[model samples]
Every structure is written in structure tokens, then in C-alpha cells.
Target: MDFETVIGLEVHAQMLTDTKIFCSCSTKFGGTPNSHTCPVCLGMPGVLPVLNKKVVEYAMKMALATNCEINKSCEFARKNYFYPDLPKGYQISQYAYPIAEHGYVLLDVNGEQKKIGITRIHMEEDAGKLIHDEHNPVSYVDLNRTGVPLIEIVSEPDMRSPEEAADYLKRLHEILVYLEICDGNMEEGSFRCDANVSIRPRGQKEFGTRTELKNMNSFRNVQRALEYEIKRQQYLVENGGTVVQETRLWDDAQGATNSMRSKEEAHDYRYFPDPDLVPILVDDAWVEKIKADLPELPLAKRERFVNEYQIPAYDAGVLTADKTLALYYEEVVKLCGKPKVASNWLMGDVMRFLNEDKRSIRECPIKTESLAEMIKLIDEGAISGKMAKEVVEDMYKTGKSPQDIIKEKGLVQITDEGELIKTITSIIEANQAQAAEYRSGKEKVFGFFVGQVMKATKGKANPQLVNELLKKMLAG
Candidate 1:
């Protein structure tokens, strides 16, 4: 029997706020262990936790961006749990009332648009880190991350494949980054995902036993872990073994999932409304303010890039994948007034250079005006495309202007009609047999004469001028 994979992702995005959600401690990462801690964050005796208004505003911005309905009133609850990383003994989160609910994001899967349902998005505090010593059997706890603001986005079991799950995750990451609410750094743990996956018979209405996968740090790993887990469940069911409900950890080295512990149901947390914190009330004015400030999302921008710029959808998708890169492309197009040319250069050579250095668009050495000017030079036949290739590399290497590099290298296109005519005449004279063949209707030999002319001129002749002069001289 064939099996259908069901996947739902729970994403935890760290808000870009200056201070902790309920304390005045710094929210910066990579500080001395426990140096950013304070009495409120440490849960000291008689310490009152005050909510950060900025946290609520950021949450509202994300809700509006994702099309989630903001709750008029939401309350915080205590999730009773015991863990070393959680210094409060019980984590303060939303249970009975969450901040937003019932949202959706569209994904482009197999050239078709797929909509993924969002169950809810809530605000919570992040737990601390537990550092384990590799050399010895010792463990350390750092409470610096304690009380940091977080927004948990829970998706419905709408994805049918690992690829769809990855696309959905990328869409969310892009939106968050575009809104500037989250940095969307997976390696730094700013944006994290937990996937719950199961496999059931294709025609069955009921679901199979599911497992929660953790420790997937990157988007590729999330899809890989889900794929591995789905296969594992299918094999177990086919071999007459019962699939167990548990929490699993993805071992990246082994490329497999290992059972960690039994999964906990919601009732296991013993959730209850917190007495210390007051209920959050979001009025119409607040939601409208956030909605008005929301930036154009990735999908919308991609469509605009295609429709307005007359570029291919694939090019638009690649160009709009990153917010910074998208902004850079738009600036170049605006300066040069050539959309397709700008797209080709950025997506081809510019991206190649960035990938080779493992640098982001923000760190790109080539300036936008410089690239626009280079494209203009190519348009005016001031330099051949081949010469521009070298010039672009030099610009990237030294952050120099293309015109200056062109002048320094003396790599000017030979657009002079008289100079090109003399070279073409010499090529036709030397290639007598090929020139005779061309006059005898051997049209393919025309390319050979063009190659000879370009070689004679050191590839400096304008290609259009070469073709025009070659056809006229060969015919004569």
C-alpha cells in the first residue's frame, strides 16, 4: 500500500528587540555566559515581570504580515515543566489565548501554487542554553537567553511532501526577514523549526502515529529529517511493526532520527493563566497601524517583478528570494533603466561572485551604480561583452568603476567602421577557400570568417559591426 506523508511545522522566530520580553536584560547574542541576566529574568524572589510593549508591537507586525487575525485580548499562561535550561521552572507562554490565529501562506510547488494553513502564532519567552563539555562529563547552564521574546508560528498538517515543507519554511523565513522583525538566521538559532510528521495509507481518512523531529538547524536538514522519518514509519508499518509516538532527535552525522522520549500531550504541561501578567488588549487602531506599515511580501514582489519588469518568473523568483538582494536589483534597474539586462547580470555573474566568496549581497564589493554604468557601456557598444566580463571581475575584486577599469586595461570596443572593414577584408583575403565556399551558398562558413575577424582584432570588434561588415564584404 502506498503511504501519504503529512507534515506540520512549528517555527520559533526570535524578535529583533533590544531587551528581554519581561525584563531589562540585554537580548544580544554571544556575550559572556550569564552576563546579561537580571533579577526579573532570573526569576528571583518578589521580582515582578513587566511585559515589553515593543514585543507586542513586533508580534503584531508579524501577524499582519502573515494575514493572521489579531486577538482583541490575549493572556499569558504558565507551562509547568522542569528543565535545566528553563530557570523559571515553569515557562510563561500562551495557552488559553494566543495573539493571532487562522492565517495562510502560499507556496510555489511544482509550478503550482499551494496554500498552507497557519493554526496560530503566539508570543513567548525563550529558554536558556545548556552547554555540555566535550572533553569531560560536565554541563553548564547560561541564562543569558532567558526571557528573550519569541513568536511561535504553528502550521496545519497541509504539506504532503518534504519539498512542500521546505518551501513553506522558506516562505515564512522570507516574510519574516522582509518585515525586519526577525533576522532569519538559522545557524545562529534565530529562526528554528520543529516538524511533526506521519505516514498513513493514501486513501485513509484517519492519521497514523506521528513523531516530533528536533535538532534540524537548516532548511535542508528539516526536509531531510522529515524524509527519513517518513520512510522509517512506512517501513515499520509494512514490516508488521507498530509505529510509536515519540519525540526524536535528528543525528546529522548519521543521517537518521533517534528516539529521544515519549511525546508529551498538551495536558502534560499543566497550563494555567499566569497571575502576574495582565491580558494583552489589541485595539483596531493598533492593528491598523501595523497593517499599514507592513512591507510588500516576497510573493507579491515576485509577481510585480515579472509583470512590471517583463522578466521571466524564474528570474524574478531568484532575484526576490532575499530582501537585500531584491533591493539591490531594483536599485540597479532603476539606475540603468534596463530590467532584463540588470536581471541577467545580477543573477548570472553577480550571484556567481557572491557564492564563490560565500558573501551575502550586503557584503558585495561591487556598487549598484557601477554595475548600472557597466550595462550602459555594453548597450552603447563602447565595450564588448567579453571585455566587460574581465572588467566586472576587476570591479568586484578592487571595488573600482567599470569605465576606469576599461580605460586602464585599454579594452575598448573597435566600433570604427573603417577599422573593422580593413580587418574583415584581410580575413576574407586569408580565408580564400572559405570565402569562395561562402559565395557558393555555403552559408555556414560565414561564422568562420567572423571568428577570424574577432581573433585578428583581439575580440575588441563590436559583434554587430563585425556581422554587418562581414556579410557585406563576403557578398562583394
Candidate 2:
């Protein structure tokens, strides 16, 4: 029987707030374990939780960016559970009324645009981390991350393949980063995903027994886990075996899902309204204020890059992928005022150097103004493109300006027409056979003579001037 894979993603994005969701604890990622905790976040007795206003604002920004309708009134609920990592014995989250609902994110899979429906986006608190000692059978729990602000974005089961799921996740991540709500750093667990996957008859209208796959921190892992789950379900169905409905953990090393626990029904959590917190009321003025502060998102910035700067769509897409890279590219363009040249340097030399050094654009040693200066020198015939690349490499290593490098290395182009003519005259007399071939209408020989002249001048000769002088002397 033909089968179709159904997949949905539950993404938990840690909000970029200075404090915890319901307490005044620090929300910083890396610190001494348990250093950022507070009495309220630690779930001590007699402590009441207070909502952070900044968390709500950041959540609102994300909802607006993802085309979700924000609920004017929303309330928090208690999710009762017990785990070693959750000190509260119950997690504070939204149950009945979420902050955002019925949103859609547009994704382009192989040039075909598709809209993935977002079922809901709710605010919640993150659990702490449990570190297991490899040398011994002991576990350690760090409460630093407990009560950190999180937005749980749940998507409908609309994706059919792993690639679609990956595209959806990527587009969602871009939106989150663009909104400045989440850093979207998978390495540090700032953004995580739980994939729900099932397989049913190709034309069936009803859903299959879906299993939730967790522990996917990166897009690659999400796709891989989904693909593995799809095959597992298909094999079970083909053999007339039942696929269990449970929550599974993705073993990345094994490349398969292991059963974690039986899936919990909605009533399992025994969710109730939190009496300590009041219902959130958002007014028109607050929404308008956040809307006005929203920066130009990726799509709008890409369109502007293409229309205003005349860059290719591919280049625009890459330049705007990261907000930091986009800002850097824009600043370079502004300083040099050459869109194509700036794009080339940024994509080629700058990105290459960054990758080689394992650094981000923020850690780059060369400033945008310095890079612009290098490009400007090449544009004005003061240096050759090859020479400019050398100077850029030097700047990348030494953090020096183009003028300083050129002055230090004497790398200026020999644009003097008189000097170029002297070198051209010498090359023509030396390469007598190639010149004879050029005079006999073998046009390719002109390139040979030009190369000889450049080589004789140590590649500092202005290429245009050499070509002009070479053609003039060869004609004679």
C-alpha cells in the first residue's frame, strides 16, 4: 500500500530576555551551574511568580513577524509534572488561552512556495539541564536554565517530507532571529525542536498513530529523525504490526528513535489557571508600539537589496541570511558605494577568511570601512584586483588599512603610461616568435604577450594600461 508521511514540528525557542520568564533570575546561557537561579525560579515554598513584561513584548514581536494573530487577553496555567530537572514540580505555561494562534510561515522548497500552518505559539518556561557523569553513574542537575522564557511554536501536521520540515524550521528560525526575539542558536539549546511523525495510507483522510521525536537541536537532526521515523512506521505497517503512540528520543549517534515514555494526553498534565498571575491584557497602543519598532525583516531587506543595490537575488538572499552579515554588507556598500564589488569581497574573500578562522562576521578583524577602502583602491586603478586580494588577506591577519599595507609593501599598480610602455616594449622584443604569430593574425598570442608584460612587472602593472599599450605596440 502506498503511504504518506505526516510531520509537524514543536519548536521551543528561548526568548532573548535579560531575566527569567516569571522571576528576576538571569537568563544568560553559559555560567557556573546554578549561579543564575533565584528563590522564585528555584520553586521554593511561599514564593509567588511574577511575569516578566519583556517576555510578553518579545513574544508579541515574534507573533507579528510570523503573521500570527495575537490574543488581546491571555492567561497562564500550571502544568503539573515531576522531573529531576524541573524543580518546580510543575511548569508554568499557557494551556487554555495562548498568546498567538493560526499563524503561517512561507517556505520555498525547490522554488515552490508553500505555507506551513502554525497551530499555536504559547509562552512557557524552560527546564534546567541534567548532566550525567561518564566516569560514574551519577547525575547532576543545573537549575540555571529553569524558568527561562520560551515560546513553544506548534505547527499543524502539514509537512509530508523531511525536506519540507527542514525548510519550515529554517524559515521559522530566520523569522525569529529577524524579530530579535530569539538568537536561534541550536548549539547552545537556545532553539530546539520536537518532531511529530506518522505514516498512513497515501489517500487516507484520518491521521495515523503519531509518535513525538525529541532532542533535535539542529535542522539536520530534525530532518534525519523524521526520515527515520517515517521508515520505521512504514515497516511496521507493512508487516501488520502496530506503531505505538509514544514520545521517543532521537539518538543522533544511532540515527534512530528510542521510546522515551508513553505519550501523555491533554488531561495528563492536569492543567489549571495559575492563581498567582493575572490575565495579560494587551491594548492597541502596545501592539502599535511594537509594530513601529519592528525592523525590516529578511524578505523586505532582500527585496531592497535587489531593487536598490541591483544585486542578484541569490546574493541578496545570502547577504540577508544573518542580520549581522546583512548589516556588515550594507555598511561596506555604503562606505565603498559599489554594490557588486562589495558583494564580491564579502562573499568571497571575507567569508572565506571567516570560515578558515572559525569566526563569525562579528569576530572578523577587518572593518567594513577598511574593506571598502581596499575595494576603492582597486576601482581607482591604484591597485590591481589580484593585488587588492593580497592586501585584504594582510588586513585580515594584521587589522591594518589598505593604505598602510600598500605603503608598507609598495603594492601600488604601475598605472604610469610611460612605465607600462617601457615594459611592453621590452616584452614585445623578447617574445619575438609569439609577436610574429600575433602579427600573422593569431589573435590569441596577444594574451600571451600581455601575461609576459605583467609577469615582468611583478603583476603590479595596471592590466588595462598594459592591454592598451600591448595592442598599440603590437599593431605597430
Candidate 3:
């Protein structure tokens, strides 16, 4: 029987606020284990929590960007759980009333558009990290992240494949970063996802038993985890084993999912509205203020790149994947006025270097202005495309301008008409048979003469000049 995979993601994005959601503690990623803790965040007795206004503003920005309808009034609730990482016996989160709801994210899968429904986006505080000692049987709790502000985005079960889940995740991540609300750093746990995966018969209207997958730290891992989970459930159902509802941890190294515990239903949390914190009333003025300051998001920028810049949709998507990189491409285009050239070099060599070193485009050594200058050099016939690549490498290494590298390395293109004609004549005389065949019916042999001339000039010869001069010389 044919089966279809169902996936829904719950993404937790750490807001870029300077302080925790309900406390005045620093929200920095790395610090001493308990240095950033306080009475408010540590859940000490006789301490009352105060909500951070900035956190709400950031959440509103994301909601508006994702087309979510903001709830003018919402309340916080306590989620009951027992874990060492959660210093507070119960976590403060949204249950009865969330911040936003009824949104959708659009993705393009193989030239076809797909819409993934967003159930809700709510505000919550992150739990602390539990550091387990490898050498001994002891574990430590780091309370620095105890009260970090996070907005959890819950997606409806609209994705039918692992790729669709990954695509939706990336689209969400890109928008969050573009809005500058979250850093979207998966390694540091700023942006993370929990996937709910199940498999059911293709024609069935009902859903199958689902398992929640956690500890997917990267986009690639999210796809891998979902793929593995889907296959495992399908195997069990095919072998006459009943699918169990539970939570699982993705073992990346083992490439499998291990049972963590039985999944908890809604009542397990014993949720209730918090008495200390009142309902938040997000007025129209506040939402409009955030909307006015919003930057152009990825989807809008991608459409502009294709329609205005005349580049391919794929190139536009890649260039706009990261906000910083997209800005860099635009600056280069502004400098050179050649969007296609800038897009090619940025997507080709610039991305290659960034990916190779595991670096962000913001950390790129080559300046956008310098890249524009290099493209200008290519347009002016000062260097060939191949030679410009070498200059770009040197520029990336020393952060030098292309002109300085070319002058220092003596890699100027041989554009002199007289010099190129003399070299082409010499090549024609050396290869008389091929040249004669070119004068006859063997038109394909013309490329041989051009290659010979370029080889003689060591790839510095102006290719257009070489072709024109070679054709004129061989005509006789």
C-alpha cells in the first residue's frame, strides 16, 4: 500500500532582546553556568516576574511578516513539568490565548507553489541547558538560558514530505533573520525546531499515530530526522506492529530515532492562566508601528530580484536566502550596474568560499565594492573571466583590490590588436593543415586556432579580439 508522510513543525525562535522575557538577566548565549541567573528567572521564592515589552514587539514583527493575525489581547499560562533544566517547576507559556494565529507560509516545490498553514505563534520562556559530564555520571544545569524569551511557531500538518518540511523551516528562518528579530543561529540554539511526523495510507482521510522529534540542530538534520522517522513508522505498520504515540530523540550519528518517553496530552500540563501576569493588550498602534519599520522580506526581495534584476528565480532565491548576503549582492550591483554578472560571481565564487570555511557572508573578507571593481575590470577587457577568478582569490585572502592584485601579479589581459594579430598569424603558420581545413569546408576547426592563440598568450589574450583577429587572419 502507498503511504504519505505527514509533518508539522514547532519552531522556537529566541528573540534578539537584550534581556530575558520576564527578568532583567542577560540573554547572551554563552556565559558562566549560573552567572546570568537572578531571583526572577531562577524562580526563587517571593519573586514576581515582569514581562518584557520588547519581547512582545519582536513577536509582533514576526507575526506581521508571516501574515499572522495578531491577537489584541492574550494571556500567559503555566505549563507543569518536572525537569532539572527547568528551574521553575512550571514553565510560563501561552495556552488559552496565544499572540497570533491563522497564518500561512508559502513555498515553491519544483516550480509548484505549496502553502503550509500556521496554527499559532505564542510567547514562552526557554528552559535552561543540562550539561552532562562525559567522564563521570554527574550532570550540571546551566541556568544562563533559563528565562530566554522565545516565540514558538506551531505549523499545521500540511507538509507531506521531508523536503517540504525543510523548505518551510528555511522560509521561516529566513524571514525571522530578515526581520532582525532572531539571529537564527541553529548551532547556538537560537532557532530550533521540533517535528511531528506520521505516515498514513495515501487515500486515507484520517491521520496516523505521530511521534515528536527533537534535538534537530540544523536544517539538514531536520530533513534527515523526518525521513528516518517516516521510514521507521512505515516499516512498523507494514510488519504488523502498532504505531505508538511517544516523543523521540534524533540520534544523528546513529541515524535513528530513540524512544524518549510517552507523549503528553494537553491535560498533562495542567495549564491555567497565570495570576501574576495579566492579559497583554496589543493595540493597533503597536502592531502598525512594527509594521511600518519592517524591512523587505525574502519573498518580496526574491520577486524583485527576478523581475527587476532579470536574474533567474533560482539565483534570486539563493542570493536572498540570507539578508546580509542579499544586501551585499545589491551593493555590488549598484556599483557595477550589471546584475547578472554580480549575481554569477556572488553565487559562484563568493558562496563557494563562504561554504568552504563554514563562514557567514558577513564574515567574508572580500568587500562588495572590490568585487564590483573586479567585474568592471572584466567588462573593460583588463582581464579575462578565468584571470578574474584568480584575482578574486587573492582579494579574498589579503582583502586587496583587484587592480592591485593584477598589477602586482602582472596578469593584465593582452588586448593590443597588433600583438594579438601577430600571435594569431604565428599559430596559423605553425598549424597550416588545420588553418587550411578551416579555410575549406571544416568550419568547426576555427576553435582550434582560437585555442592555440589563447594558449600562446597564457589565457591573458582578449578572447573577443583573438576570435575576430584569428578569423580575419585565417580568411586569407
The most accurate candidate by TM-score is 1
TM-scores of the models, in the order given: 0.96, 0.94, 0.94
Instruction: Report the C-alpha displacement of residue 312, candidate 3, in angstroms.
Output: 0.4
Candidate 3 per-residue lDDT over residues 70-164, each given as its tens digit: 99999999999888989879999999899999999999988998889999999999999998999999999889998899999999999999999
Q: Which regions of candidate 2 are displaced past 4 Å?
A: 133-138, 261-267, 430-434
Q: What is the C-alpha lDDT of each candidate?
A: 0.92, 0.91, 0.92
Error of 1 at 313 (Å): 1.2
lDDT of 2 by residue, 376-405 (tens): 899899999988889999999999999999
Q: Comparing candidate 2 with candidate 3, which one achieves the higher lDDT?
A: 3
RMSD in angstroms between candidate 3 and the native structure over all alpha carbons: 2.3
lDDT of 2 at 188: 95
lDDT by residue (343-418, candidate 1, tens digit) is 9999999899999999999999999999999999999999988888998899999999998999899899999999
Per-residue lDDT, model 2, residue 418, is 89
